[model samples]
Every structure is written in structure tokens, then in C-alpha cells.
Target: MNTSLKLKLGLLVFLLVLSVVTIVPSFYSATPDWWKKYMAPEGLRLGLDLQGGMHLVLKVDLKKAEENSLELAANDLKDTLSEQSVSAIRTPSVSPDTVIFTLPNTSSIEQVKKLVAEDFPDIDTKIESQEGSFPRIILTLKDAKKDYIKKHSVDQSLEIIRNRIDQFGVAEPVIIRQGEDEIVIQLPGVKDPKRAMKLLGDTAQLEFKLVAEPAGLNLNELIEKAKKSGQWKDGEDLKKLNRALQNQLPSDTTISFEKEVDPQTKVERITPLLLENKTLMTGEMVKDAQVRIGGTFNEPYVSLDLTGRGGKVFGQLTEKNVGRRMAIVLDNNVRSAPVIRERILGGSAQISGTFTHEEASDLAIVLRVGALPAPVDIIQNMTVGASLGQDSINKGLTSGVFGTIMVIGF
Candidate 1:
């Protein structure tokens, strides 16, 4: 061959070799160690529709998020009233988008209205007439504000889910918001779909609250009351529990459960505990979290390191409430409530529960990524197995071989 022809042939051979090198990893699961070290490591990433994985459609509970917002607003109003020295005759009642409260006097109602107008711009306050002598006020979240919270909750949930998937070490995950309140997630090559689902579905909201010292109402009796009301079952119906305890609970206190399952009998037991409703800190203030083995039991647990502001607040909380029980709550379940022996000064804390290694790791991942703004329900879950993926690869390879032969012959 002439020099020019020889150069062209060499270039063609080089291009062919490069293409094969780039594509071989996708076909073979295991390559030579030297090849991995020397050659490019990345392979072609296929989607769930091609490579076979998990497909999930999660529906964001935007209405529940609105209720959560209302609850927070009600708490803030209570704090505002306390700060302004306006005594409330009753605890604020929070619905999905409204807060109802009764003031001691009509003079305090105007002050409360002014505070709501100045501090809570999203709430519309109305005087709902006097009950006997106390003035009743109802604060409803504005329609625009509710819509905004719902929209923002979806966006925040999407980001948090994406972060979690990325941390879970998926090569390439397809996470996108669908419509107004739905999220579509495609996880390729996930070996454990059930675990992945659990990780994704967890809201991971963490809170620190003080367990009420003088818990007046009996929690067991309260659980019986909840069961009689037909609103609670096996500690799952938190809203119903709240409703059942509405009249019995103290003004500043609420109830949550600590869930435990017996390994031998597989029976689930829930121990209810009274907790202060005011949240001293949240997972948003967490800087880092990791799974660690406990020294005494050798069991897996999560270690938390808080941010600067979180450290300050936590320190103050511990300092003021020395010898009091502080509850570590996750997704409304009380994980652990230990007495504050001394001020926890350095922002470090531990959450110990009956967790396997995998569960502890997943919890750390979610806490590190931060909590989802709202809860998500898995409306659709479909798992595609490796056999399906292999079939797809076989068909693709057959088509490619035929096309190559035709091109060469042509």
C-alpha cells in the first residue's frame, strides 16, 4: 500500500480498537484488573427501561405538608403570645390550614391580630365571636400561601430524594418531579429494590424535644382511649392519637410512640410517651451523620454532628433542662429519650435503636442528606429483574452484529 493509504488504514484500525475498548465493559461484567487500572473505567449506562431496574411513582402528600405548616404556625403563634404576655385560655387547635385559639380578653385579641399581621403575613386572622367572655380567633392560611407551600414542598422533596439516591451510590438515577405532586424515580441495577424503596419513602424528619416531666395523663389509658375512638391502631395513626389526646393532654404537651418489635415472637409493641410540642432543633441543622457501632452492645447506631447554630441551641437546651429527659424523634416516632446528665457542649449526639447495619447506614445517609419537606407515598412500584436486562442486551447485540455485517458487505 502507498503511504497515504497505509495512514488511512491505520487510522481506521485505531478507531475500531477505541470503539471496542469503550463498549466492552458494558458487555462483560468482569474485566481484567489491568484493563480497569489502565483503560477508561466508565461503561455505557442504560436506563431502567433498557437495563431493568426499579421504577417508582411517589405521590407527595402536599395536603399533609400544608397541615404541618399550619401546625408550625400555630406553635409560632403560641410563642408570640407568650412573648407578648398575652395569656391564652386554651392551646391552639391546628387543622390542615387553620389555627383556632381563644384569648383571655378582647384587648389581647387586637394585639394578637396585629402580631399575626406583622409576623405571620401568610395567615388571615378573623374574630370568631366570644365564647362566654373569652374572644375566639381563627387564623387561616391564605390560599396563595397554601399553594406556595405545596409547590415548595414538592420541589424540596425532589431535591432531597435526588441527594439520597446519589448518596446511595447509584451510578445514574433518574429522579424527576412529575406534574404538581408526583415524583418519578428510575433506579438502574439496584440489587435490593425493597431496601431502596424504604430509603426513598422515608421522610427522615428529625426533631429534638423535651419529654414532659410531670406527664399527667396515663399513656396506656390514652392508647386504650385512642383504640376505643377507632382512630388509632398499632401506633400508626398519629393524627388520630393527637385527636384522642386533645382533651386529655396538657396544654404544652403531645404524645408520640416508641415502636419495638420482638425478634422471637414478631409481635410489635408501642410505648407512648408525652413530649413537648415545641421543637428545639431539627435535622436541617445537622452538619454530618454516620453509622457507628455502640460500645456496650456492639449494635449499629447513628452519630450526629450539628451545625454551629444547632450546637448553640442544643447546648442551651441541655443546660437549661439538666436532668430532664430529651426525646430524639424521627418521623414522629420517638427513637430515644435519655436524661440530660450534663450540657452536651460540642454538638455531637448519638441515636441508638434496634437497627441492623444496613438500616443504620441508610438512616445516616438520609440524615446527612437532610429531611424531605413532606411525606411521599409510593403509588407505584415495579421491579425489573436482571434476566430482562440480559434479554435487552442480547437483542441489542444481535442487531449491532447484523448491521455491522451489512455495512461491511455493502
Candidate 2:
């Protein structure tokens, strides 16, 4: 080869080698703590078909949300009438905020119309008289309220579901709202498919009750006794209680239930049990949560850092409830119900469990993400064994290498 040609050929060879080496390593670079081996080389999350795991399509129950919304509107109307001294009123039937019912001889159609128009004036009212029958006032939402309800109903539902899934201890889970009322959740490398399904399917609405004050009793001593006896069964009846407790609380305290909800009124009242704002302190308040170090040689523990608000809440709650058992409920199951020894205002907490390093890490991930946006229905679930995924990886690597060599030679 001529001297100049040789130099040019050498440079070309070096450039090709650099591309091959750099490209392959770039494809195999160490992933972030959140996006590890399970992630695709291109920074995109790999689908089940590519990496192999469970893929689920969840159809969110839109009808159920609508029904709940109307029930809320109806309850609001009942309360408004009761407060206004309207007697002999029955529970109203609702269709998206149109409350339909008859008042007894005490109230006339005009009086009811005026009542609704003045008090619950957000909705439209139509008063009609029936011969030999009591007059009726039909209250429905205005166009603006209807549009807002239609817009936010799905979004709120999705948020609650997302919160539940994030607490489920699934690593690298993908939950997305699909159509108007459908959700899709992808769990990668999950060993227990049923566990994932159960967690995602759960409606993990949380409540904080004033553990009814023991009369003239030593709270600290009683808490200690309860702790020793292990009487607080955190997981046993939460699901049952959640379902049965609906619509039972007083109107002022019932956050999730309403007798008459309308798109026009959008009367959403926070239950007394909930914080005044009706928002729960979430895991996003956690800056970071990781496995703790330096216990027994192989012992596992989880350490957490809370955001400012979370730190304040955790600190205050722990301070006042010292010696009392506070249940750390995730997805409505008591993950840990440790006795608060003192205020944990330092924005950090440590939870010790009989877990492996991997298990502790997984739990940290679960607690860190907090909750999902909506309830997810797992329409499909498939578990691929580790060996199967490995086989696919082998085949994929072989095909890639063969194609590369063929391209080079040709």
C-alpha cells in the first residue's frame, strides 16, 4: 500500500473499532438505581415482549366512579335541605347530579326550587307540578360543571390507583392510563405475579382514627400492653372495613361517600378523619429511601428520608403518639406497626425487617414511590421464568453478533 493510503486505511480501521467498542459499551452502561438491568439499552423502558415479564391491561371502572360522583351530589343536597330546616325530605335519586325526588306536603315545588336555586345554586333547577301529586324540582349540573366533572373524574380515579401500585413493592413498574377508563400496568421481572395483581387491584384508601381515648387510662402502659399482646391485626379486616364503612360516617365526616352528587354542584367534602385538606401525606414526601447498613453481618433494614412536610407530619405524629402503636399502612396493609419511642423529626426513619438485601431494597423502592394514580384492573397476567428470559437474551445476542459479522464481511 502507498504510504498515504496506509495512513488513511489505519485511521479508518481505528474509527471503526472505536465505534464498535463505544457503541457496545454504551448499550451496556451501568443503569441508574431506578433503571437497572431491566431497562433497555436505549434509555427506553423495555416491554415485556423484549425483556419478558408480566403485561396487564386494566380497564378502569368508569361507571363506578360516575355512580359514586352522583351519590356524593345527592348527599350534599340532602344535607343542604336539612340545614335549611326543610323537613319530610327523602333521600334523592341521582343521575350525574340531577337529584329527583318529592318533598312531603310541608314543602311546595316553588319553595324547593328556591331552596335549590339559592343554596345549591351551582346546578340548574327545573320545577314541574303533577296533578294530585307533590311538586318536584329536578336539579342538574350546568354545562361548565359537567365539563369539569367529566375531565377530572378519570384523573382522580387514576391518581388513587397509582398510589396503590407504588406501595406494592414492584420494581420498575409502568402504570399508564390508557383510554377514558382503562389502565395498563407493566411489571418487569416480578417473581410473584399474583402478588403484583393483588397490589395493583387494591383500593388502598387510608384512614387515621383517634384510637378512642381510654378513659382515665395510662396511654403509654396500654400501648405497651397492646404491643406485647400483638392485638393490632393490621391487615386482617382493612379491606372489609373499607367497604363496610362507606356511607356510614356522619355527613360531615364522610369523605368518600355522598347521597346526592351532581356534575353541576361538584360538592366534594373532606371527611373529618382525613386531614382538613383531605390530602394524605404521600411517599413523594420521601427524598430517598434505601437499605440501612451495619446491623448484623447479613441483617437487613430500610432507612428513609422525608420531605419537609413529611418530616413535620412524621415528627409531630410520632411525638404525640409516643409509646402508641402507629400502623404504617401501605396499600391498606400494615407493613410495619412499630411503637413510636420518640419524635422522628429528623426527616429520617429506619425500619428493621427480616429481609435479605434485595428484599429490603425492593421495599425501599415501594415506600419511596408512595401510591399510584388510579385503580388498576389486571386484565391479563403472564409470568416468565428467569430461565426463559435468559434463553431469549442468548438468542438475541447470537442474532445480533451474527448480523454484525455478516455486515462486516459483505
Candidate 3:
């Protein structure tokens, strides 16, 4: 062989080897997860048409998502103000597109002006001068702040919903924001569409609240008090009470009405065991949950394992309040009222209920998913069968082979 030709052949061989080393791994990583069942990494994507699976176009309710975000922000703001000894009048039964509040008499007007500007920069407020001896603060969004709230709030909402879905334990879910205000959730091989919807659609914000026994206080009277004071909406009151029970209290204690002792009694008015604004527990500290059998039966119940801080808190609470009933409230509804039989210092606890194994597992899944910062609206869902996925793989392979053949022929 001529010297130049020999060099050319050597260079070509080296390049071929390099391509095999680099390109092969690229192909492996690019393999569709669905295709992994057949062979491992044959590369490329599977289309819905070829797969014969469901194709869904989800319309993201941007407005709803934004509202959810605002609601969360409002809650956070309310909590913050309450913690600072600044009371906020409960949000009126009006559209969430606009939220309003009244400041407590103890609140400093000048301090509020600075705090409102600093704390809730997104919340544009217009403060009225001492109008007839009563100085009032009006909160409404300016154009720029409204725009900011819309986009950022939607993004945060999408992230939270995505986290919720991923934690659903589905093998390979495709959850992505389709547009500025929309999300696309694809659950391949999901057998139960209804279950998936139920899990995802629920806005579960678990809170631990000290119960307050209405005692002699009439339900109608408390309702009227909530209405008249303008400082407490029923829902807000419920959430606030739960948050107090979960984490805000100084001592690791919880208070529930002695009435909750009878599991059979569904309707009972029981006061929470602890003081207001005290949180003995929160879902944020829970690391994971599973359906497990208790020491008693093969009967199913949810086993909770707390994160480090949560474990410490749970242990302390259990140790301090050994004889009290802790209210396990989910979205303001009591799920279980379990007594502190003993101090649980192991960083794990189980919630027993009138639940089947499946129900326990489902509840476990929900707890494992963590609480969302705000609510979520499921705009769309698509499920792909295994057969359809296989068909997609075959069609994709055929197309690739034909394309390669044509390229070689050329």
C-alpha cells in the first residue's frame, strides 16, 4: 500500500473504534424506558400513534393554578402575620382572584406599611389614611405585581403538582408543563384511571390542630362569631387550628376532646388538647409511609416514618403527652384520633383506622407524597397499555431500519 493510503486506513480504523466507544453508550442512555423490556438500549423515542396508547392534550388551568398559588401565599402570609401578633381578618367569601384583609388594632400602621412592602412584595396594597378615626389597609394587586404573581405562581404550582405525581409510585410517568400555564401528565401502564385521578386531584394539606370544644358554645354562635369578627373564616379557622396542633405549640402536646375516644361516634364536638398557634406536627417532616400490619391484626394501617427533625418532634410530643389524644387531621377533617399509648421514640408511628389493606396503602401513598404548597387541578391524563407500547417499539424499529438501509444505499 502507498504510504498516504496506509495512513488514511489507520486513521479510519481509529475513528471507527472511537465512534464505537462513544456512540454506543449514547445509544444505551437514549433507549426508551419502555423499550428496556425487550432488549436494553436500542435508542430513540416511541410515538403515541405507533404505540396505540391514549393521547391526551391537557389544558392547564393557568387561572386556577395561579389562584392556588395565591391561596398558598395568602395562607403563608396569614400564618406569618399571626405569628407576629398581627391579626388578619379572614378572607371574605369572595373570588380568590382578589383577596382582602383587615389589620388588628394592635398592629402599627407605619410598621405594616413597611412590612407589607417588604414581606409580600407580590401583594400590592393601598393603605387608606385614618378614615373617620379608623385607619384601614386595602390590599389589591397592581398590574406589574399581578403579572409577576401569575407567572411565578403558576410555575410553583406546576413544580408542586409534578412532585405530587412523581411520588404517586408509578413506574414511568411523563409530567411536564406544556406551556406557560399548562401541564401534561402521562401515566403509562396505569391500570386504574379513576384511582390516579382521585390521588392527583385531591388537594390534601394535612395539618395538626388542637381541638377546641364548642362546649356550651353553639355551632350557630361560633359560625356567627366567625362571621362577625371578620377575623376567622370557617376554613381558615380550621386550617389555623390544625397548624397549631401540628407544630406551633411550645410543648410537644396535643389536645382533642375526650369525646373522640369512641371511634364509633362519628359526630362529636371535641376541643383540641393544646393552646392556639402551637404546631406539634406537620407532614413536611415525614420521610415515608407504608401500609403495614400492626401488632394486633393482619388488618392494614399506615406506618409513618418521620425525618430527623420530625422523629425528634414526634418523640418529644409522645413523651410529654403520654396520655392525651392527638388529632390527625387531613385538610381540616379528622382521620384518626389515636391516644399516646406510650412514648414513641423510634421515629416511626402507625395510624390505625377502619381501613382495608388497599385503603391503608392508598393513604400511605398520599402521606409519602408530602403536602403540596397549594391545590392542584388535573387538566388532563393519558394512559398507555403495554401492548400499545410494544407496537410503538416495533414500528419505530422498522422505520429506523428502513432509514438506515436508504442511507447506506445512497
Q: All candidates' TM-scores?
A: 0.92, 0.47, 0.57
- Please rank every candidate by TM-score, starting with the best: 1, 3, 2
lDDT of 2 at 86: 64
Least accurate 10 contiguous residues by lDDT in model 1: 88-97
lDDT (10s digit) by residue, model 1, range 1-410: 79999999999999999988887777776878667566747768877767778989999998888877777787788877988898765444544456678887777877888888888998888896655767888877889988898769988999999999998999889898899999999999898988999999999999999998563667888778778877787637686677767777777678888777664566877777889888988898899999998655688899999999989998999999999999999998899898999988998899987888999999999999988878899999989777766787789889999999999999
Q: What ranking of all candidate models by lDDT puts the best one first?
A: 1, 3, 2
lDDT of each: 0.85, 0.55, 0.60
Worst 10 residues of 2 by lDDT: 270-279
Please give the lDDT score for candidate 1.
0.85
Best by TM-score: 1
User: Candidate 2 regions off by >4 Å?
Assistant: 1-12, 15-51, 60-177, 185-210, 213-287, 293-299, 318-323, 340-344, 349-359, 383-410
Which of 2 and 3 is the better model by TM-score?
A: 3
TM-score of 1: 0.92
> Tell me, what's the RMSD of every candidate?
2.5, 12.2, 9.4
